[model samples]
Target: MKATVERATLMKSLGHVQSVVERRNTIPILSNVLIETSENGEIKLTATDLDLQIVESFAANNVETAGSITVPAHTLFDIVRKLPDGSEVQLNAADGRMAVNAGRARFSLQTLPRDDFPKIAEGDLPTSFEMPSSTLMEIIEKTRFAISSDETRYYLNGIFMHVSDDAEPTLKAAATDGHRLARYTLARPAGAEGMPDVIIPKKCVTEIHKLLGEAGDNMVRVDLSASKIRFTFAASVLTSKLIDGTFPDYNRVIPTGNDKLLTINPKAFFQGVDRVATIATERTRAVKMALEQDKITLSVTSPENGTAAEEVSGTYSNDEFEIGFNANYLKDILNEIESDTVELHLADASAPTLIREHDKSPSLYVLMPMRV
Candidate 1:
């Protein structure tokens, strides 16, 4: 394969592909990226770890020959990243080695046969839809933080995506780690009416977010089956296997009878919780919230670290009550709130608390209380 590509363009595409290649691989070919050239003036790079795969293509004005080869993904990415800006990179593969040259820098890397690279066979994808890249990104951002890292409950390690028609036909994305849950809803896209519920693994969700960074003003095409999902956006394609477990019925955990409401500036409330959390125990990291009419006080007491408290004024007229919650979890939920004001609906200090934007936006959060 002999092809010339711009340094910046090559570096960007390499960055996206290399991220899918694992640093430690039992199979030799899995650590390398497959590079292919075509007569249509395009260079394609593909990387995979068996479970997930990413392919990206970029225009190459100069293609002396069309061929395919595999080389160390990280090494190639490093070489392109350090190359001089605006310089063209020349790649030539032959005799089981690949030569890379740019200006005064020269490097040779061992190449593997492209036939050794594994490909995931995408069966008939009965469900397909197109949605704006911005909307898909928003869905991932709002719920990914709550995805569980616990391997025991393998089912909770991803965001659950499905279509809901209970109120208005909407697409919902939800994630939870048992202590906190986040759910975001948006109008269902045109081709998503009969889509099956799927759990998108955490790593795949992360890669999708990164790929969408360059997808300015573009729409993302999503195709899926019961076992796999694929996303296509802006000269790139990502395919991932779905997690093989059923997500719990999240609606049961979302409280419906919480009537007490407290509205406060999210920024101020987040700052207060952060300050008081400094004195919390390292094991629990608990913060105590005491709410009353027009005022709320956040306090933390640790035997080893002493005590800290901060008073934040808000619009709450309910009876005074104290609730305990994980300080980090509270701060994480607050950071995602884009609105100036946030509402927290409470039912005493023992039940799960419902939180959302003051305007009742489509996003909703449920945080379970802990003992301080």
Candidate 2:
């Protein structure tokens, strides 16, 4: 394959495709990106790790011949990244090697047969929808932080997304790690209703987020099946196999009747929590929240270290209550809440607290209390 492409265009597309390629792989081809030049003057880059695949194509000029080859994704990305700005990059594949040249910098990389690249066969995407990039990004941001890292309970390791077909159709994204859970809802897209819910794996969520974040003002086309999901837009496609486990019923855990409300400036509250958590131990990074009248004291005690506490001003008038929670978990929810004011609904000292935007949001957070 021989193609001359603009440095900036190739660099951007390589950056996207390379992220999907795993750094360490037992299979040789999985570590390389599939580069193919078409007769129409478009060069396509594809990378996959069997479970996830991404294909991105960009326009190129001065194509002498049409062919396909696979080269190290990261190495190629690094070459393009370091190339002089606005320079033309030439790529040629011959004799089992790929030559990359830009300006005076020249490099040759080993190539794997393009036929070795794996492809995900998504039979028929019965469910399809179109969502704004901003909305999809919000959904991922609000819930991805709570994805479980514990592999034993694999079901809790990804975001659960589904279209709620009720009186008001809505799209819901939820995630939990047993200690904390995040739920975000948005208006349902036209073609997503009645589709089977899918548990999108954590890595898939990460890659999808990276792409959408870079995509400014672009719309995403979502296609879903029982076992796989695909996001296609802007000359690129990201497809991943669904996690093979059932997500727990998230609604059952969302606390109800937690009436005691405490409203505080999220920025201030988050800052105080972060500051106090510095003195906390890794094993038990617990923070005690002592709420009474209109003030809350966030305190952390470590036997090896000393005690650190901060008094955060809040709006609470009910009976005094003290609750213990994992400091990191508390901060996780606080950071996801975008509202200026954060509302914490408490039942008592030992119940799950609901953290949400003060002005009723479709998104809500549930944090289980821990003994201080």
Candidate 3:
């Protein structure tokens, strides 16, 4: 393929597509990006890692002839990025090698056959809908921290997205690591009817976040099939294979009748945990929470490192209660809360605790207490 493209445009598109290509590959073609020029002179770039795939299209200035070729993703990206921002770049494939030229610099890269690149099949997507980019971002940011890193329970390695009706036809996203669970809901998209529950893999969640962050538009189109899901933005499409196992029913883990309520300044609580956790050991980073009539104290002690304690002013009228939780879990929930204060509902030390922002919204967080 031969084409002349703007340096800045090519660099930006390559930066996005190249991230999908793995630095080390079992298959040589997987390390290269497929570049094809259309009749109208637009350039299309595609990259895949067998599990995730991305295709991006952009306008190019001139086309010598319509052709396709595969070239090393990282090499092409570096060559374009080093060129002057507005300089015009020319790329041509001849005699099994690709050549890139801009101004006074030129580089030749080994090329792979485009036919060797794997293609992700576009399955029959039964449910298709459009959701605001901001809404999708909120769902991911709130629940992604709780996704399990444990590969044993492979089902819990990704965010569980499904339709719910406790209040309305809401889009609920839930994640759990057996110790903590985070669940958040957003208003269902306008035409998102009859959507099935799907577990989007953790890698897909992260890639979608990057794509949405760069997308300046308002909404994104989502298409879901039985085994795969595709997210389409203005000029890019991300296709990912869904996890195969069944996700655990998360509702049972959420405590239903937690009576004790403690309202505390989120900033104060987070700061206290941060300070007390300093004394905690690397292996056991546990912080103890002692709640009384109108005061709360956070303490952490390690056999080798001694103890650290901090008192944070809070509004608590319930009976005396003490619980221990992983300091990292507390920090994750507090970081996601936007309100000034957070409400903690507890039943006992052994039961799960419920957390929510000051506003009476549908979102809630449940954390399993750790043994102190």
Highest TM-score model number = 1
Question: Which candidate do you rate higher for lDDT, 1 or 3?
Answer: 1
Pick out the ten consecutive residues of candidate 3 with the lowest summed lDDT. 357-366
lDDT (Cα atoms) of all candidates against the true structure: 0.94, 0.91, 0.90
| Candidate closer to the true structure by TM-score (higher is better), 1 or 3 | 1
Instruction: Give the per-residue lDDT of model 1 (tens digit) for 1-372.
Output: 899999999999999999999999999999999999998999999999999999999999699999999999999999999999999999999999999999999999999999999998989888999999999999999999999999999999999999999768999999999999999989998888899999999999999999887899799999999999999988999999999999999999999999899999999999999999987777759899999899999999888888898999899988888999999999999999999899999997789999999545989999999887
How does each model score on TM-score?
A: 0.98, 0.97, 0.97
Of candidate 1, the 10-residue stretch with the lowest lDDT total is: 277-286
Off by over 4 Å in 2: none
Of the pair 2 and 3, which is ahead by lDDT?
Answer: 2
Off by over 4 Å in 1: none
Best by lDDT: 1
Residue clash pairs of candidate 1: none
The clash tally of candidate 2 reads: 0
